[model samples]
Target: MSPLISSFRIAIAAGVLSLFALPAGAAELSKELSTAVTHAGLAAGSPDLKMVQTHLHHVVNCLVGPAGAGFDSGQANPCKDQGTGAIPDAPADKQKLLLTAAALAQGGLAETDLAKAQAAATATQAAIKGAE
Candidate 1:
């Protein structure tokens, strides 16, 4: 192979490999917050209390991340690759908003009534959006 062709191939190969090499916790905090918002909206729109609780749990899980307090291991994290956790990864100012969203999500999880859970979910979504 010609030297120039070999150099081009090496560069192309390096670029391709770099595409898959995302650093640990490289996902932006906004992505996780948005994911939390999505789950919260889903919870708010749920037709039943059980589904509301389920989606709320997802919101909490995403906000808190795997290592954060209130993170539930049993619930699926919709923001798994989107950052460590929205609350922990957020900047100081935005952390407060995420924390509020987390509290609302936790509250929604504790509620037994469908209306209250839905309300909490709506509030949680709003709080997360506030950080944006």
Candidate 2:
């Protein structure tokens, strides 16, 4: 194989292996989060209701739920008003993502923070795609 092709293949292999290394709960959460953010990014790119809703849903189910992957962070949920997850003061973008996710799960998808959520979701989706 050409060196470039070999390197690309190796990188892909590494990424796949890394994904497999996540524990079951964490893997599920990551997969759900990645999928939700990808969907959100495609909806409107910014302040998109679809994106916000999807992100929120996944966040609650995967990160905030009792069986969630929240344990992976070893930190309380920063976005939670009174619980543990990431931390309340995580990066602004990250905070938006987590807060929106929580809100979506909490049935409070207000329009006020949709922009932030959209940005967070889009950025996260971009990062995941870049990894691929």
Candidate 3:
């Protein structure tokens, strides 16, 4: 295989391995977060949703894998690293939005939190577009 293809395979393998290694709680959280993002993406029809989803997946891999593979892997935290050294001071509405996304990424919204889920989906769309 070409060098690029080989590298891609290695990365993919590493990501998969990482997911399997997450601590149960972190793995669960990551799953919820990933699900939320995916649902939101599908709802929003935003192309940048793919990029956000990829990043969220990497977060899961990092949590489950060797050191330097998860969100705390020295790379800035995407959720908190929104161009600020500190976690951005998102408004209550935005916090709900992110929480909903994280929840959805981890698992489907509970019936009571469906509104939050929709907000999260919207926030994800806006966040991705702003990043671009």
Candidate 4:
């Protein structure tokens, strides 16, 4: 298989594995995080519009999913401005995503960066009341 195809497959597999790694009972948090991890995996393997878009959505969701889902952190909501939801629809958001995708496509993110992103997601989820 071509390198792209191989990378895509690897990304897909990584997503599936992430789901199994999550602890039970945090269904809501886990779902979004799993999706984000999946998208990140895809970008790491091979960047593309779809993968990057999805990656941003999930990453943002990871940071804001609890608030969007109404977890009520009490201190201050991370995704309060999100209102109903947050999708990368704005022109600027799109451009940023495209740029990120291109950069990732050129060369996947560093392992440390990926790990930091993953850790951020976990911390964000923990911040939400009842999300952990």
TM-scores for every candidate against the unseen true structure: 0.79, 0.31, 0.27, 0.27
State candidate 3's TM-score: 0.27
Q: After superposition, how far is residue 89 of candidate 1 from its true place, in Å?
A: 0.9
- Per-residue alpha-carbon lDDT of model 1 for 41-101, expressed as tens digits? 9999999999999999999999888999998899898988777888888778788888888
Against the hidden true structure, what lDDT does model 1 obtain?
Answer: 0.88
User: Any idea what lDDT model 2 has?
Assistant: 0.46
- Can you rank all candidates by TM-score, best first? 1, 2, 4, 3
Residue-by-residue lDDT tens digits, candidate 2, 49-99: 755654444444333434444322332222233223332323345545555
Worst 10 contiguous positions by lDDT, candidate 2: 75-84
lDDT of 2 at 13: 99
- Which pairs of residues clash in candidate 2, taking residues 3 or more apart in a chain or in different chains? 40-51, 56-101, 76-84, 76-85, 77-84, 77-85, 77-86, 78-87, 78-88
Between prediction 3 and prediction 4, which has the larger TM-score?
Answer: 4
Could you say which candidate leads in TM-score?
Answer: 1
**Model 4 shows how many backbone clashes?**
0
TM-score of candidate 4 relative to the true fold: 0.27
Model 4 over residues 1-132: C-alpha lDDT tens digits?
999999999999999999787344334334433444444454434334444334434444433345343223432333333332222222342334333332332232222355444443333323221221
| Per-model lDDT | 0.88, 0.46, 0.40, 0.39
Best by lDDT: 1
**Model 3: residues >4 Å from true position, as ranges?**
1-20, 46-97, 100-120, 125-132
Q: C-alpha displacement of 13 in model 3, angstroms?
A: 19
Q: What are the per-residue Cα lDDT tens digits for candidate 3 across 4-120?
A: 999999999999998789565444444434443443466434245444344444332222232221233543243332212111223344445443334333332222254443444
